[model samples]
Target: MSVGGGGNGEILVRVENLKKWFPVAAAGLSFAAKREWVQAVDDVSFEIAKGETLGLVGESGCGKTTVGRTVARLYEPTAGKVVFDGQSIYELPAEEMRQVRRKIQMIFQDPYASLNPRMTVGDIVGEPIDINRLATGEARKNRIFELLETVGLNREHASRFPHEFSGGQRQRIGLARSLAADPSFIICDEPISALDVSIQAQVVNMLQDLQEKMGLTYLFIAHDLAMVKHISNRVAVMYLGKIVEVADGYELYAHPVHPYTTALLSAIPIPDPGVEEERRRIILEGDVPSPINPPSGCHFRTRCRLAQPVCSEKEPELVDRGAGQKVACWVT
Candidate 1:
């Protein structure tokens, strides 16, 4: 319930030096070719307090979704730790980890692809409940209907399939299913990117309401900077599989420290014509370096306008710059 993730200093989720790398086959048909690794998430560290929403924003291929999946334990972490509710999840046994899973859930992007076409809305929402053995018979049915109505869907529509509903409705069903687990922390990975503009607001508002009611913690991942600013207590900017800056929503937007964060904030358009015309956009040169073979020092230095000699020789650590704002830049 705090503004900048400072709620009694109680950390519900802590990710430390997390890394997820996938093996990429060498090009062409060669027996002796070396297999390379695509560093999707590299040494990413952050924390989400109880009842706090930490928005993770970056461009496509920035490994935001991968971070969410890794935290949810969908992908086996190549390195580092993911601690949930004071327990190290990766180190837990199978049965113990199964219990931990019920407390951590993920709402994936692409509502259509995420849901099973063969399953009805009711079945999709109730699957988690059944898996966890939370209820049965009439009790299970009532729980499903309650979840449906809670997400602003008609109880009668439960009998219908995913194809029978619109995109927004399908997303609502996804929300219902995530809630079915009675999760304490939910990773929302671009949950609204596939919906209409108006529907995006509706779903986001509903998420805020549910978080308030259920006292849930969220790691909201998305490309919508404005939306992230609106929903998140704190925002973390990622680039080239690494977090560049982390700060309070207001502080980050008003005064971005990292060069990449400043450029990203500049790209968000202003509605007012006068302000839009006067605003100076910091357009960086060069494309984002490949994660497979990132730059020597700072991954962002190749595209950064303020890149100095040291930036290419030494990678900067994420040092706190008062008021809990952390930045990984030599020049900042």
Candidate 2:
């Protein structure tokens, strides 16, 4: 399903019928070479406004990250169109794509892993500037310090190694590096998932502040529904490599139509004891089906509590139900 209507600014990113599949090869004597396609991200479509946060939520292995990577052109999509800034990203030449890269950046999930342990924090953050040839000599150093300060880090910290900093600080460094390229769009791929609960809030708030001050757009991919609700302007729920439900943040949480979206919302813990006790938790039975061979028709039908005969017989296309909400369920 897609969000309709474009505003004043040209659509910064438009993903149409995107798909990413990996081949799974059989082990043992089955080395006779049967290839099964793992549908990581299938036929997903969406558009991100010039300055908006589109939070993509799903359980692990639901291909949220794959979608972000595919859109970022980190992974060559098996099939689909990725139009960024009015140009087809996949069709662009290497040199043209390199220029586009400056406009789009990524903040990785793991602060520790994403930062190279061997490199100094200054080097780590400045690498982008150096690669882009944006600045040099004292000018480069000044730019690095400015980035560090922008992300709430002191210039002195740049001299230290990543191993010396806390997880939250490392994430700040990652943010600094991302900003060094002066990108308008950033793919925040679960940037806070690895931090402590307290640290997570700090990092998230910093990102919000940066967005406000810089007018940055984001494709936030995370499994944390509560955090997504807090940060996102709009949200998209993914299942089996497809977007099952998409709506404004408050709208989606208040009136989730898709069965899978309902189940996910039910699982989020309510702080109020009375509400927590009264809420019925939707415990989805059966494991998620393998992407290599997802179920026919509705991918969620296998475990959907409200599934009907038609759900199993035909795939539901995402249809608009008014109020800027789209759902892909037969019952909805």
Candidate 3:
């Protein structure tokens, strides 16, 4: 695998105008038919400085996972740049890309489905270390044991298969695998979404502790606003394959700018029934438009209650407001 020099300064990962569009074929005769596409991630951009956690929040099917995958180079982008530790991954040779894998890893959304049912937990955790030639024999086994313990699982559990464990344990095993390579960055793709509600906080807290210990940078993708707020240093709100707002986590939560963002924040359930009942809910109108044929200008305009004529005529650029806050809307 090819290996480029480490990136400049503090930024560990940078994505520039990233786009991943899946092609859609013509239904019938294609002698002269034009190709169609599903814009999974359209012109999204962001950066993760070393040791920082950036939360990505959005409704289901809003391309949040696609952005994470595309940024990690799991999916070959249709257009855009992904620079890791100063190297442009898409521009690397196959072998070079393989080497880069050690520095970047991902924790999948479904804990049960993510782990290989046929493999023992020890083997699953040790696979990355083996692939990277980081350890072997007694050393590899020892490393696996250490990893299992690190993720809050007992060393004895390593010999068991994935099916023998519960949802949270499976996720811990998956996390152990990601850490096998001692990656500097991880894309957590809704890592707690499938676990029992009670188990979610344990995983999140474990991830936080691991991040602090390893000095890891993360792109945390999820729809759980409350969890995101607790874990993220900064947050970006995505809608219809586009980022509508990006700001400090607390700032964004306290003062959402875009109409879509406002609507989303409003839907988060407050714990106290009195407070929830007192707050006004902003219910958005209309369904999310098909990615294959999104609205002409701002994709969210179709459902935005405050959308104006200018929103349909031209796409609003993501402009900075202050203190690292940015919003893509005409009226905020």
Candidate 4:
């Protein structure tokens, strides 16, 4: 796979102080009881430059998907601003937002569940065209076929049902659908996670090819560090709901500052037996703390081996650590 460089340009998607908290209510007793908010995403801020792919990597339930969904306007953020192309997306009215939706699209995690079973592959891929009124009849059908071919699928397969295809094929179909409207920004929420291990490289390569050809920007959210390193220009390591570190992909892998980032990179399996044996695995004890009632200051403090008293007392703001990298750990 060829790694492409990002061009200098204005920010395409800017998420400032983003927060998405889901309410969790008690099952039993009174219906009028107050609900507790699950802090899915808390005070997260980042910017994606035009034509840049910023991979958001973290463990499951770290609110990566929530951040992506909130940016895509699928879920209304509890607070903060989502600015797209110099305009505040959250502030847009329904009519205007409909147009904004065309430029921003999402490829969900589950390809099988994301596609409509009742609809054929043609309708599934052409739904965006119909909604945006970009094309109709023969023109729309031709566009759908074009998209299918773009994502490595044959035009003939467009008429088949999604259930008839394999997992990888379904994901390619999903990609074709997302590209139907020619979106500039795509939120790839673990798009390859559900596919076979062998097919993961193919999907990643396809995305990389499409990004270069179409000048597409991606908010690539996934837990696969290896894949992220391969495809992303830069990567943001997220812990709890906040981004702990952000740096160039190679730089972050070579010189990870945050304890959490260090531990995550250490876990990536090495191919060479001797090298793997020599590498030290940094294991953090215990599960991630509940988002509803997270630790007082640094969320990772509970599992952090280098945690000091000050870590629990104050939250660490993501600060520049020289060389265009930012880290949010007290020790770092």
lDDT tens readout by residue for model 1, 145-248:
99999999989998999999999999999999999989999999999999999999999999999999999999999999999999999999999899999998
Question: Model 4: which ten-residue window has the lowest total lDDT?
Answer: 1-10
Q: In candidate 3, what are the lDDT values of residues 1-332, reduced to their tens digit?
A: 01111233388888888999999896689679888999989998888888888899999878999999888788999999989999999999989999998889999999878988999999999999988999999999999999999999988998899999989989999999999999999999999999988899899999999999989988999999889988988888899899888888888888888888889999899899899879999987767888998898898988887888988999888888777788999867
The alpha-carbon root-mean-square deviation between model 4 and the true structure, to one decimal in Å, is 3.3
Q: Give the C-alpha miss distance for residue 135 in model 2, angstroms.
A: 0.3
- Per-residue CA lDDT of model 2 for 1-332, tens digit only, reads 56653345457889999999988776556556676789999899998888888999999889999999999999999999988889999999999899999999999999989999999988998998988999999999999999999999999988999999999999999999999999999999999999999999999999999999999999999999999989988899999899999998899989999999999999899889999989999998988899988998999999998888998888898899888788999986
TM-score for candidate 4, residues paired by index: 0.96
Error of 2 at 35 (Å): 1.0
After superposition, which runs of candidate 1 have C-alpha atoms over 4 Å from their true positions? 1-5
Native-referenced Cα lDDT, model 4: 0.90
Q: After superposition, how far is residue 238 of candidate 3 from its true place, in Å?
A: 0.5
Q: Candidates' TM-scores?
A: 0.97, 0.97, 0.96, 0.96
What number of clashing residue pairs does each candidate have, in the order they appear? Answer: 0, 0, 6, 0
Tell me the spans in candidate 4 whose CA falls farther than 4 Å from its real position: 1-7, 27-34
With a 3 Å backbone cut-off (N, CA, C), the pairs that clash in candidate 1 are: none
